[model samples]
Target chain A: MQESATTIAIAPDQPAPRLLEKAVVGAGARVGELAEADALIWTGKPRDFPSTLPASVRWAQLPAAGIEDFFDAGVFTAHPAVQFTSAAGAFSHSVAEHALMLLLAGVRYLPEQLRATSWQQREFFPHVGSLRGKTVTIVGAGGIGRALIPMLTPLGAHVIAVNRSGRPVSGDNIPAGVETVPTDQLARVWSHTDHVVVAAPATAQTRHLIGADELSRLKPSSWVINVARGSLIDTDALVDALTGNSIGGAGLDVTDPEPLPDGHPLWTLPNAIITPHDSNPPQLRLAAFADHVGANVARFVAGEPLEAIIDTARGY
Target chain B: MQESATTIAIAPDQPAPRLLEKAVVGAGARVGELAEADALIWTGKPRDFPSTLPASVRWAQLPAAGIEDFFDAGVFTAHPAVQFTSAAGAFSHSVAEHALMLLLAGVRYLPEQLRATSWQQREFFPHVGSLRGKTVTIVGAGGIGRALIPMLTPLGAHVIAVNRSGRPVSGDNIPAGVETVPTDQLARVWSHTDHVVVAAPATAQTRHLIGADELSRLKPSSWVINVARGSLIDTDALVDALTGNSIGGAGLDVTDPEPLPDGHPLWTLPNAIITPHDSNPPQLRLAAFADHVGANVARFVAGEPLEAIIDTARGY
Candidate 1:
């Protein structure tokens, strides 16, 4: 049987044409006539797309990891039967590494040394903490969490996984001696964990998952690393935590009202280390997402179950 | 058969009662009959004591890790045959952690962030190198070096051990799968390594091991972390390397002068992060040294091999 023709309809603004074509069409066909295609790959700003699409489009794949743009464009609500999956694991390793970087940076007091270059004498320096003997509580023990656990375990840290389902996932790569805790145990784990890495998908239930009360449970020396989403934490509450020294510090890759406006108090907080939500190291996200898309495309061709299928009702 | 009394000498300026009771006499031995003893334990500044010690002393144990002070006092020369041992492995773990802190700090660009907190949100911050995929060359792979290998391995760094003998020393707890290179391969490995951690003992032959020419071989992105004595690296050469950005950066826990003088150019170097040689974490030195001393004391009593026995000829 001839392979079904595919048309990858990427936004004009998308920087990577090769990536989009490879992800959607694979090696089976050329991007000849878009009008006679069976599949469509959507990318970039959805606001510029037409109100309606062709009936021949059997499936539509989004280029971005988060599907909020599709929702904002009312495509998901309008097309009820369309299959929806995300590039969820696309940036898992990069996000995990970013979180680890922040944790190590905070514990080692990189900021303090940077600020006071004049006082670089050996006798009057500050003593900093190490990651070797600490417990790390990873909220949302999915792909990113899984990636982080192995990285942390080798550094001599205890890994605790907390997920929404309250059930443990199976994988050989999970560090051999990690504790998988359900989300219900979060508050308890927070009381003692040395670091908290928020990697959960942003859903209604997860919004403000870590707020004032939860932050209070953490040790004064604890650090929070958020690579998941800004809504997963309460911004105002976090500012309080850092200012009061209730929790040691934070390494934020994402934040509320991102592109965090100029003169934001967080920029000045001595303990808060903020990055522009661009934590994905060069080529890491592309490689991961490409693998995901490839695997899904293969399964689609074989009439097999697609991995990482999103549930609209769950909003993940 | 009575475990014959061992006489220990107490210097005049020493804490008289305690030294006399503990070192000169065993606990509960007659304190007044100080002259009736078989051996002498030296417990005061050698200069304060007479030039010639009583020939009754069979061994001398110094309180410091480096026996340079005792050697300076001519103790080694005056009694060449007297078995001498100094506390070793005392600061191994602390120094190892300090080395890791510096490496992490340099790679994460902690120094830069503190300088530009005001404009942190306006633009995309530069991506700093990560230790996740790097080759670390550890010079003088002794106690501290061995302790650090395990820590570096977990962070996914390749550790190459460079030492005098070029023979493989068993790093019992050092993570498996690390490579060991002879000193002759130092220049060859320097070009390939992303990090250089100097842990060699300060010695005449080992001085300036990482000088101008050797440093010039390193990639511009590589970092140097020195937890070993400062003399191992030529201060002037390192300053030039930092100023020129020939090597990426440096984290120095120990410098030539114990207190790196205020207004020193090294303190102001943008690429260099200096900590006043006080990398030893609180109580680590005391506890580890005490354990070493206790072990040696037991070995002495049982006629067993001692730990960290200093080689007078090598002066390490």
Candidate 2:
């Protein structure tokens, strides 16, 4: 094991520096100025990361679950010596709940009926669907996927989890009854599933992983739910499918080129339920990140392996 | 016990007489003409029930969970000699799932976001809530309520169920971990609850049960979700509260004067999600009712007691 970190700095801070500092102190680490620290807990946006870190710093912690920001900002390549960890599992429960909300919203046409100027019961009745006796394929069987499995199983959904390497889920928090498969088998699983939930991290290999070809394999009554990242699906293909009524619907929390332009067709699509990527909103994110920092800081101080360590090459 | 019904009839039947006939026959009861039927499955709208029934008809099975329709139409009072059973628990799963959808939609401002013309994540962020660490009081701890408790408990909610008699749930399907309370105690449960789901059958005692007084007792942040009957909540009081932002929001599947006329204030309310009371849409209702009829027919033919037997005076 590596030696314990003697000092750490909270960097480019805006929201919860004091809360994070308290957490660091609670974890038996002394807070020091950025230049003098052996480790840094980064709380600012990835674009705000300093061009260089002092030689004293051995590791840095990121505040967000998706580390694509750092990769896009060239932070990892720029600082080859720094080991980085992300607040991945910290907010999974809340996000997973939101994803379930989106999936159910799509099933019941909550979005369409909510916007109706007149009573639409008869019109919407035929389209109303249920999660019961349905099969849902969850891409990226990590923390969020694990949290969602328990909720889905009780509702009678057969959960097919697609992980990068299809490692067996081994945590006490993880529920049984989920069938895990590697990403390679995702193509084979689509036809049998009633719903598809994208929860995988945004990586080059996963980008546009579910495009026209994959969507074609799904039933016309199937719903595609994206809670991970927008880039995972090809937006154009999604728009075509929704417009053509080829697929049942989509429940998207994230979109490519997000903050999807004002007049975007997706905003008006009846089958598409878009939430502007607010799955894990600000207040919840702050508390969850703080929790992650506190635990990771304790681990760092104890010379223990950290949670959510990122693979720089994968860019998750 | 009533003698076994050798023959049955699927009556008035707008939705699925053929399906019910098949179910009845599948249960070993022959489908005969109405006048010759010893048992009748009333599959049409309650208003359509014949004013007089043949003396041969010993039992009449209702195709709906809400038996208030029969009582309101004077069918039960007119035929006091006929035993009646409701298709209650059969469709509870679908309705319970819809209730969960509404609760989550109310928390996440799904309706508001769905209507937004532009990306509104930041605007909607502060209002987004989660079921986690929430206390949800479920009014009407019957079939739908029981099914919902298991889903809510797994999501970290403390479920307080309110029933007519507040009897401890005893069915095998009734999941444990819910605290059952009488409807009379609803006043005390509001302030502590983050959300309230109304699933009670609409009866004389339940009309306007959640009015200005009950709404006033709740925290302003609390959400009121009605998936049962519109009358359970006073629409006028709800409008006033929603207009004044007195409560957090509402996810309403049923409404007073349902098929709420165009230009109703609710149609434009930002916080209120009105869904035309389509929670248990046609397709699911048919299959569920068929299942109930099949099971009850088998029980009746075997000289066993029926399920969901309705008390004429109580009107549930």
Candidate 3:
């Protein structure tokens, strides 16, 4: 069958960004008016979403990874017939990169070195560590976990990706030989894995995933990095581990009582490295989003399965 | 023509190391005695090296990157016929990994975050930076510079490699598209490159390579990382840049005078990160050396050219 050129529309601006416009054209699609376009790229909020989409508009691409606000605003309900895809994996690269930085910093004992006023090479020699040949277990094998696998693999780290199912995580960027495990079997990994990176969602079942019991199983030099939601790790238990030097340290972008209250013990802890949760900042998001748009547009043109499909029933 | 099985001897220790044995065997060679072996893997001190080697010994693998001690001990002068490959690139991975951590930490404003006792997300948002789409000019296309290219590429950064020859840097692991420039033209790059990583050697021509002239040209957000000798960057110039906020920050593994004095300002500078020249700790050196042995042994068995051939006159 012969293919025809597809048309896509960008909303909330009379002239969309040159980046988004170029993305559409680069994907073999053209930027057109909403009335004639076959797809709509929503760059505005849920409230700004059109109550009605053209019948020709079979798909819509949202700018956010999570669309709870869109669902609450009834954008999904207003266009139940249209296929929806959220920007899920696009922003993951930056977050995954942050996790790697935190992990490397903690393992190499950068926190203590930063606070030093004198050369302590002899005293700090034993504390320096490397990720080479070390097993890094990433909880919640979603966008962040999958993004992290490739980055870690090049550094000679073995990855154990955990999800609800034991299905192996595979991608062009993610190298082969990665071990996959079910979330229920997480206990088996704590004692064996060298370090942990929390990238799971904040669900009731996942709350406190790394508590006192799990922290105790980790090696004294193991660093715990959290780029996901704050609740996944037990903050009190983490403080205990850092205070006692039972584990190496904690690199947290998120915390249980986030914006981690002023004067929190974590602030004073020498072993903790905090970043105030700015892994994926605003300046980087637009370009990442534009890239996502390009990929999905190409997929739509090919009539292939689109990425990050939103499940209306699940309200994801 | 048929190839003969190669024999390698591990000196000083009768058993040598099971790790080195496995590496030799894995590379399709076998372990044998010094008198009958075709190659020698020296794991002992320079003083312990044999004054004479078997006529059959065609190649030798030394365990140190910088063989000044071996040269001082007259090991090379003693054996003029055998080919020598020093452990140069093997240990660069650990040091390169440390460089990546420091660059990321400085760009993401990690030092301030580590010192914060309150949730400073709003205040920190503007400071958090991403390496994606940024230019990273790596000074010295030696082991560490080459090793780091692949690691940074995965994070979406453009690389500029500076070397004496200006030859394009290419390797099995290094991706294509890296821009190479000759050292004489380095003055033109400071205004354009987003970050700088000093991995060059310490020599008369290289002393204070990044001085007042270079530091003054860099952007306010540019980060300079030095895993090489601290002499490459002028201490006074770097301090001025950091204090004036002329550049983003500096991540230093080596400092001036080796074991910086107790009251040095680099230690207390918020924009500076000092690691006390421990990027390649002793504990991690052996494994890295073994990997280097495996690759060179495989080449020897195949009668191919080996890596890191030392030039006695250069004294590297």
Candidate 4:
């Protein structure tokens, strides 16, 4: 049988439909109308998925890496025929770099150091630290975690990665010399680590994963860095830990009740360095998403196994 | 010939005289009185060098890497017999990491990001950027510059290192693939670079090395990170550049007229991040200095060439 041209559509609800259309066309896929679209590039929120998804569509490409929202929305239970793929690893590079940035900032106390109006050299000296000879625990051995390993290793940090399973993750992204452990072992790893970077996907099981118990396990000199969803950490516990000087510091790119309200204690905390949930650089977001779409479209056209296919049961 | 016992005195004015004394004794050197010492560790300010020097001392170790003060004091011109070694590379790891921290903070608009009390995600998206694929120009291809190259290279930055000779420095400290360029060509390189990290020593020739003329050559989006000495960049020009948005931003750990006075314009500028010259962690400083002293004392006992020996003529 002769190969047929794949019919895809730039969803009307996408953040930038024109950009999606350009990417689809650039990838050699025809932009079909709603009734004819075999696949869709979904750019809308998970809550809006049910209303926007067409019965004709066989595949749906989600812009977000996290899919816990979809599971909560019951998309999997409703649509058995459609194959869903999330942009899981598309923004890994950007996000991993941000995590490193946050870690570096926390270790060096950049926030407090930058706040000084006077020469506070003597006061700041004891707080400053180098990443060298430090132990870093990455809680979530996925794309972002893998990307962070190489960057951290080059700085002489011993990286310990945590995944759902203790098994080794196979990928070019996984730098050599990293110790992979299961999530349950996170407690055992805390006391030895000087830094903890949260990159786990948000789920009921993982929510508040770094709560009071986990915070208490960490050394007084340890810093907590979260580039993943803020829900992964317990904000109340974090605030307490930071305020009470339980932990060295925290670099949070995401926060619970995000767009953290005005007069939040985190805003005033000297140890807290918040970046408004923007780990993925806005300048690189669309381009990276486009690249993912372009590659996946080619795979779909070739009748090959797709990348980032969401396991309906796993919801990652 | 058997190595003679070397008597060394830990300077009274040193930050941690007890630690220095312990290290010297630990390295097989006896702690002697200043008048009877064969070698001494001088930890006083550069201006106090002439008054503090003892004629009987044959070898003196300066705690700071930059020795511009000795040149102005005419100590080198007067005493040609005594061998002087500065703790040049001992603190490189700490300082380089701090420089990287400053660069990352500036690129992410950390100063602005931390200022937000609400989510303001959309407002921050456009300002966000990553160090990946950025051109970083590191002034002074010495220990800190060399250390920074490897760290930046892993993040995919094209590193251009500037030195007095513009020749590739030979040492394990120097990372591969970095382009070593002469200081004279800085004007030509600025437009292409996204960031400039000043790690040059403070000297008459280097004072105000990055003034208006140099700042103007850079792209308006470029960030300037200084971890070396405040004198390298003209502070007045820096404040003007940041305030006018002539450049992207400035991350200064060191500033002129040290302890930048309260109410300084640079303090209020949203684009400036000042850290009060505390790049070297105080915890690491004494230990690193002691290691350097121990190694140099060993070399002195063996009558071998010392490490970090200063060429007073060069005024570094």
Candidate 5:
């Protein structure tokens, strides 16, 4: 509306999503045409990205966290002058929420209670556990893990955020009491923490991080929740521990042989809660991306550093 | 031990429970016999309470939150000089945690997911909801409601705490953003909030607070969680809402005609989650009570006003 107002264009939708339009405008930026806009908020696939962009467009916001396809599509090379930001951390809140739900469900013994047809008060009493005063070792201090720490701490669960460097995960939202542990020192964590939540990226180094030996060291009441990639945990070992009731339970959104096959033991295991990797479903992504756009747009309008900026050289 | 150190006595158990003794000692008090004690920590029934207390005894801590049985036993009348404290807020954490578990479970569509034997990611995607940017109206900002507010806020929920007076609910643990509404104003909340947690006490005026009318106002995605006494909701209306898919679901730790009759339709409802009021089970009580004892002991030793002190005249 003003000469100095920053203009952001929304692509792929003839009329962009109302939420995204509101976010852009709410953050003190105006939605406008791509040719005249200062930045573009993209929701379409990398393949469909514009072959040419006007020089006025200085920034582009991608809809997905991982922009590997964008890298392969050479979207970065053609627009060398433009700054690009991915929706990396925007989607983590929902996944972090899912992790908390799984941990709470497993720790409090919800799967068993869900199956009960009658009131089993006396019988179920001993099994219902609380996280208060218990240590929850989250393997990986990434977006999801960081988001989860605050959620768990309020429920009285002590958080041990496992990162590669063991650097303390300090943030405005994260309480000061969280412990930081290095991935190399994970073996020491098993004997200490009451539960484990695997949220690490799956790499050759991270694969099978929680095997039988690690599982054996954990207490019988300990629960293991995996919201990251499935390969981070040894699924066979997990099934064995679950079958023997050696560990309390496993709440997994991701699985090793994903889709998990129809007759997998994890399906029937009383303690295992499988949610089919629907933690950050399609419907929720637009809102999260809109939030990312709003914050970045606010930054862009103010001529400040933007979030989740892509490293063109490194191909992230 | 210092000569001026506080002396608290644990009755009934020969060695007095180790945890309670540890709590007393941890809180800078020395656990001693009733004859030499300045305060008595009673874990026994109202009938088993010592008929008489030493003149040195100036305070008494009852194990349960509700001290009505102790009142019925005429314990307060006999020990007119002793200050009394009930284990009220201490045990609310577990129940609050349980309420959260139920809410998160219901909101995220866990009941249906737990029943799935195969991968149904596409089918489950739309049902998976997040608390982010959602309104959660907690009825009755008591200990449990207050405890829950802090937990929900970290997950990006805007909390509206409903109390009888609508006095703003602020505590060390509770963040500053919570909106408080009085009981009479609760009718206006159902239409706006995405979820409702019924934590209000069951009083003559509060009974059936959430009937068919209230349920009808909530959206199809709204979940109703009741951790308080079941009478606060009309079970038939709740059934209709849950059965007709008029509401998202009901996650109830307490049900009317509780111990919720074995063959009740609630037990079999796909959308209904029943935990048989076992949120605060017997097994978890000792630890919670010990925590209460520790806090009270610390307060008593510091010459500070003790928590949850019951007035003999009012009989809480």
Candidate 6:
């Protein structure tokens, strides 16, 4: 690969130090020196567009997993000619592991056991259900789902995948015995599924996909795990499902109205495990952004097709 | 496969009315009518030995997992000529799954998270360690360990096995990656292990095997899980280890003094998850004993070796 002159721009935050150290392999400059560089790397919150831009900036690499933030800022529409890419596969392992941790915690009744310790009722321990020989359904068959399939399949679970498009593709590492179903048939399969994982991207058509209607179709012993965007599930419907015992429990990494207000019902629910949207592993964002910037820089000089190029109409 | 006259014997409490109503193609007589039969099959726990046992009693099947009680009652040793077997493999899946459930529960801080919810500190979520890349040492390379290895390997964990004699043998379904170590090396390997699972049988040499010395060798972040007999771990040492934070936590299905007293200190420890001696799945013992009886019947007719034949000297 040729050593090219590229300016990798990042947000002015704590992660900026690591990003500059990793992405800038040679004598590369920052965003202020944009006029003299061939490409610009973006890693920050969305902001107003720059009026004076150089025509030489042909590609832009995003540090975030989802590019919706940039699309909302209209960065893509203004720079129609510039190719954009994102770091989607970077956080799959961390997120998938987090989801498994939550499922195991819920099913084994860990919360109740902990409380029993304080009351001197340790001898009344109950036998909790195991995840072995259970069915798990993944709603979105993307980077995260693909990574999770391999981990779940080996635990003797029957795995099924649902995708947006009608066509089905076999997961590379997923065992042959696992089944793959279409998104339209999720209602038919929901009753038999013991665990449901939602990893779909947040979009206009995907918002509130698992509302009251879908929740009603779930079995009382089933558990819902959401590692995706909070908008994918209706918070009110989920709370009702949990309270009515329509589903066994829920492990939520994201909640609607992010940074849930004090006295939220979800905080006190016995069947819920909530984290402050920090499920993503520490330093993952910086690592992902560095990879994205390196890939785009390679593509810029090699004249090859860029990875994870965003489509304006899809708004991804 | 020969159509022989068989005398089927059963304990007085045997509930076989449903089985009697099903199809019976073979010519067989009950134990009460043993005078007219050529061979004999037995079920359930027998109360006493007959003074002049019929020569037709070619086999004896007891409905139990551990035959130690029967052996202590002078049933197997006295009638050495009679082929003997007990249920073993039936409960392997349930027990192994229970061990994994406890390990996951402890590592994820499920107990602490639940307590924090009731205190109105939802924003103070803490990050616990993940089991994705941890090393788990399973003591006892018998049926339970064999069954558990396959389930845990796929969850991205490194599994190590320790057996009595340290002999290495490969089975059909055991994944190739598992490592088998001798029991003598447990102390040497304790510091590096993240999780320790005790699945060994109760024997003379195994009693108090995990006492104060062994407990002290464990790393501060390590957790102990005992699904084996109560005598395998020293209760006092375990409490001391947890109180000092010498080890991270413990998930004990069986304690030295089974059915711990009302005000035991171990019961009040925040880091310990104590389940009653009932981690075995519902109806697991019955299913296992039934399978054991069937195998013994087949072996008696074929002149083959019986399964799970306890070694009196070893006391397993």
Give me the TM-scores of chain B across the candidates: 0.69, 0.74, 0.89, 0.75, 0.94, 0.76
Instruction: Give candidate 3's TM-score.
Output: 0.88
Tens digit of per-residue lDDT, candidate 6, span A79-187: 8877777776666766776677677666666555555543332333343655666898888988778878877765567888888774564645667866777776777
Name the top TM-score candidate: 5
Provide the RMSD of all predictions against the true structure, rounded to 1 decimal.
8.5, 6.8, 4.3, 6.4, 1.7, 7.1
- lDDT-wise, the better of 1 and 3 is 3
Q: Write the number of the candidate with greater TM-score, choosing between 5 and 6.
A: 5
- Please list all clashing residue pairs in model 4, or write none if there are none: A259-B119
Reference-based lDDT, residue A83, model 2: 90
Q: lDDT: which is higher, 3 or 6?
A: 3
DockQ of each: 0.22, 0.55, 0.68, 0.55, 0.90, 0.22
Candidate 5 segments whose C-alpha is farther than 4 A from its true place: A1-4, B1-5
Candidates 3 and 5 compared by DockQ, better number = 5
lDDT of 2 at B23: 87
Better-scoring candidate (DockQ), 1 or 3: 3
Any residue pairs clashing in model 6, and if so which? Answer: none
What is the TM-score ranking, best to worst? 5, 3, 2, 4, 6, 1
Off by over 4 Å in 1: A1-90, A118-127, A166-173, A283-316, B1-90, B118-126, B284-316
For residue A294, model 1's alpha carbon misses the true position, in angstroms, by: 13
Backbone clashes per model, in order? Answer: 7, 0, 0, 1, 0, 0
lDDT of 5 by residue, A85-183 (tens): 899889889999999999999988899999999988888999999999999999999888888888888888888999999989987678988999899
TM-score of 1: 0.67
Write out the backbone clash pairs for model 3.
Answer: none
Instruction: List candidate 6 segments past 4 Å from native.
Output: A1-87, A118-127, A166-169, A283-316, B1-43, B46-63, B69-85, B118-126, B284-316
Best by DockQ: 5
What is the per-residue lDDT of model 3 for residues B168-266, given as tens digits with 9 covering 90 to 100?
A: 999899899999999999998877799999999999999999999999889999999999998999999999999999999999999887889999888
* Model 2 lDDT at residue A45: 86
Model 2: share of true interface contacts reproduced: 0.88
- Scored by Cα lDDT, where does model 4 land? 0.83
Per-residue accuracy of model 6 over B250-286 as CA lDDT, tens digit each? 9987777876776788888888888766566444444
